[model samples]
Target chain A: MQANRSRFLTIMLTLGLAFFYVPMILLVIYSFNYSKIVPVWGGWSLRWYRELFESAEVWSAVTLSLQIAFVNATFATMLGLLAGLAMVRFGRFRGRTLFGGMIVAPLVMPEVITGLSLLVFFISLNQLTGWPAERGFTTITIAHITFSMAYVAVTIQARLTGMGEDLEEAAADLGARPLKVLTAITIPRLTPALISGWLLAFTLSLDDLVIASFVTGPGSNTLPILIFSRIRTGLRPDINALATIVILVISICVAIAAILMFRQQRAEMRDQKMAEGADE
Target chain B: MTASNSVSATPWSDTDGQKPLVELRGVTKKFGDVTAVDNIDLDIYAGELFCLLGGSGCGKSTLLRMLAGFESLNSGSIKIDGVDMSDVPAYDRPTNMMFQSYALFPHMSVAKNIAFGLQQDRVPKNDIADRVQDILKLVELQDYGKRKPSQLSGGQRQRVALARALVKQPKLLLLDEPLAALDKKLRKHTQFELANIQEKVGVTFVVVTHDQEEAMTLSSRMAVMDAGRLQQIGTPTEVYEFPESRFVADFIGSANIFEGRVTEDGADHVRVQTDVCDVFIDHGQSVKEGGKIWVALRPEKIHITKSDTPVTGENQVSGVVDDIGYLGETSIYKILLPNDQIIDVTAPNQTRPMNRQHLITWEDKVNISWEPSSAMLLTS
Candidate 1:
């Protein structure tokens, strides 16, 4: 009976892994296909990759997406840090509940609704204040920041909640003012959370499609928006190559994040072991 | 030190000419509908090690926080070094606290944690390093300066916290349950170390603790609190030998309390009537005639002997030994009187018997007696 159960578990695990990885594996293999017609692979070659690299449109889209992701991650993490600190550290103040609701509303709202509402709001603001003359990279970056900040806030808030208040009190008792305590004690401890929040915001901004499509204007197409528009015409091997590159970039980023998190966990475990030994 | 010099060896005892360092007048704090710290008046002399002892929610910690300037008083004034501290913030106050958890900065090394306070004051780099090193040596954690708090042992981390708080050389140091985190043996050792550090530094120390033994061992004087009210304030011996109220008597240590009514009140002595026997107190208390009172007798003060022994006293009562708890050093006997009153009598094991049998076995009729002066008359 034990052997039977083990066999069943191995078969189920393989099936689950195949279900997740098979599509990506197929896409990667076909991206190297030299066939003009998809699903009929003639031979494996680097023609699609060459074409993908040569296309200025693809390059511009990639650059625009990178810029948006960079700017969005920086600004979103800053705003998120402020919101998270207010939620966790600040005592109750007026409109706290409303502020919390407003911060979190973007997280659960539908992407289409968010995109459309932001587009309308930007148009109205342009007409009234003439600040953003036209919807483009700025609008797209702002839209991504609006939703990505909520994710960062939730991450940071969870981290701050688990942190003990004694350290801050001890700092204050040691003659450090409130601001000094924040800089010395609170922010140093929050470095790991801030890193993870920044990474998450970057990924969300880079992968965004619907929001970018609605907010972006002429000559400001992001990678996802360009890919999505091309797919409406027909399947292209260069597009597959682009998809493969996106997947590769995301995989590398995720791998880096995982490695960092693993190192942090190991350090934390060492601390835990030392604490436990002390208890003994 | 000579006898006269020793009398004033500690600055706190030089009260003839010295003024108190900290004074609290009618200090009170309220949280919502609950009064955390009721109206309390206290004076702490300089270089004195005082303790606030109570159970959880007894407001001992709240009182310490108020002195630290973390909590504002509802209506009162606190003076430190003749300066009204009501408007002082925690960071500006001339006080520091060693939290119960130690609260060592986990991200910083022990040296950095100790230097953090001096750096906040914008002290010179050389001076901050020198003071940090001195304090690290004082706490005997000089070797662990480069280690993070999490990398150090519990006792080491506790020392780091002490060094951090002491590096600033504040006028007063507040410790909340300073030794409550240690094990039994470590706690005993650390208690002496803490008291020694307080004495060597000569900084006025105010510690809050729920452990009665910790307070008794470390404090020069302690205030026992209950339900946000001060029950009694006195030296360890005073609180132990002559507790003012029944709460204090029972809270500090075990006491055999007997309820009685005062029958005779004399200038030199007082007599009280109980169900089992008439009690005689050596000193006169302010209890009125026929007033309800409680006579408390410590277990160690009660002597138990075989009934055959000729023992005659107004405070003597005969009972059967119901239970015997043979601790290694001391044995406690629970004796049941005729009126079903269980009196605990503790006897030191001065000599061991050759046989395995105890000196006093079960069902032995014993006569328990205590001196009149040993009985404390509490009117509460």
Candidate 2:
């Protein structure tokens, strides 16, 4: 009876994993198809990949997306770090509850509503102040930052609170002033959280499509907006090939990160053994 | 009798008439409606190791933080080295604290952690390195300078925290439960090492601890606090032998307390009648003719013997042994008196017991007697 149940459980686990990955696996296989249409798979060839590499529009969109993600992550991390520090360390200022609520409001806000509201806000601001002569890269980058910063701020806030005020107080008790303590102790200790928050912000900006589309103007297409527009027309084989490459890149990055984390754990365990062994 | 003749021949004697290194007047702190520290006045002399000892939630840590400038007084003043420290920030105050958690910076190496305070002052790099090395050697961690905090044991981390604080050489050093994190055996070993380091540095150490044994061993004089107020402050012997209140008597060590009215208050001695018997004191306390008072007696001070001869006195009682607890070095007898009151009497085991049987067993009638000076009169 136990053997039968174990077999049944193993089958179910395999089916679940297949359900998650079969479509992506199929897409990767078809990207090698020498065909014009996506549904019909021709003999295996690298035709679509060559076409994708030759497309200047795709290259420009990649450049624009990378540029926006880079800038947005930097700005969002700065603003979000300040917001997180103020929320945790400012010690119950007036409107603290409201500020805390508003910082995380974008995380729960629907993408359609957020896009529409930002669109209306920008149009009104331009009408009133005659600013933002044209809306494209700058406007879309700003729009991405508005929502991306929420994730960074939440990440930073959790890490900051967990770190506690012990180290900061110890620094001050050791005779360092506030600014000196921040530099000598706090910022160095917060490096891991800051790096992770920046990466989260960067990924959020790169993955955004709706808000970027709403805020963008002519000739300014992020990679997601470009791929989505192409999909609306019809699925092209080049798009499939491009998506396969993206998946490959992301999976490689994840594998590298996991390996690095595993090595870090081993080093920590060795250090602990060293400490314990030193005692004996 | 009050305990006099403290740990003898100390260099930092109270009669030296030197100005106190730290002085607090009416120091009080309130958290909303609960007062953490209330109207406290204390003087800590330089070169003396002082401990503020208490149980949990007794505001001992709060008082230490107030001295470190991490907390502010509600309506009081603090002075350090004859300088008024009312508005001084934690960084500006000439004090450093070793936190209970150790609070070592995990990211920095041991040497960098020690040199951080010196770097903040923009001291020369060579001087900072020399000071860090010297303090590390003092704590006996000179070999682990380049190691991170995680690469060290708990005792080593504690030493790193100590080295970090002591390198700055502040006028006053505050240690909050410095050995509370270590295991039992390590805590005992480190307690003596901490005192020796403090002596070598000659810094005025203000240690806050909940462990009575730690405070007794590490401190020259200790203050016992309860419920945001100081119950008593003196040498360990004074607080243990002649407690000023019932709470101090119970908190410091084991005591059997009895309540009664004073029968007489003579110039040299006093007598009080209680539930089981009357208690006599060698020294008199100020009391009304028939006012209620409490007397505390230590278990070890009472002599218990097999009841062969009848005994009756003001400071003696006769009872039947109810139970016997055989400790390694001593034996405890729970005796039931004729008046249905049970009292504890402990006697040293001068001879070894065979087959787990001692001189006093269950149902044995025993006479317990204590000297008049052994009974502490508590009139509060």
TM-score of each: 0.95, 0.96
Model 1: how far is A145 from its true place, Å?
Answer: 1.6
| The candidate that achieves the highest DockQ relative to the unseen native structure | 2
Weakest ten-residue segment in model 1 chain B by summed lDDT: B6-15
lDDT of 1 by residue, B1-380 (tens): 76577455444445575678999999999999999999999888888799999999999999999999888899989999999998889999999999988988888888999998898889999998889888999988777778788887777778888888888999999999988787789899999999999989889899999999999999988999998889998889999998999999999989999899999999999999987688888887788999999989899999888875544448988888999999989999999988899999899988787797777889998898888899898988
**Number of backbone collisions per candidate:** 0, 0
How high is the lDDT of residue B54 in model 1?
A: 96
> What C-alpha lDDT, on a 0 to 100 scale, does residue B332 get in candidate 2?
87
Candidate 1 DockQ, CA atoms: 0.62
lDDT of 2 by residue, B28-87 (tens): 999999999999888888888999999999999999999998888898899999999988
Among these predicted structures, which one has the highest TM-score? 2
DockQ of each: 0.62, 0.83
Which segments of model 1 are wrong by more than 4 Å?
A265-280, B1-17, B308-313
TM-score of chain B of each: 0.95, 0.93
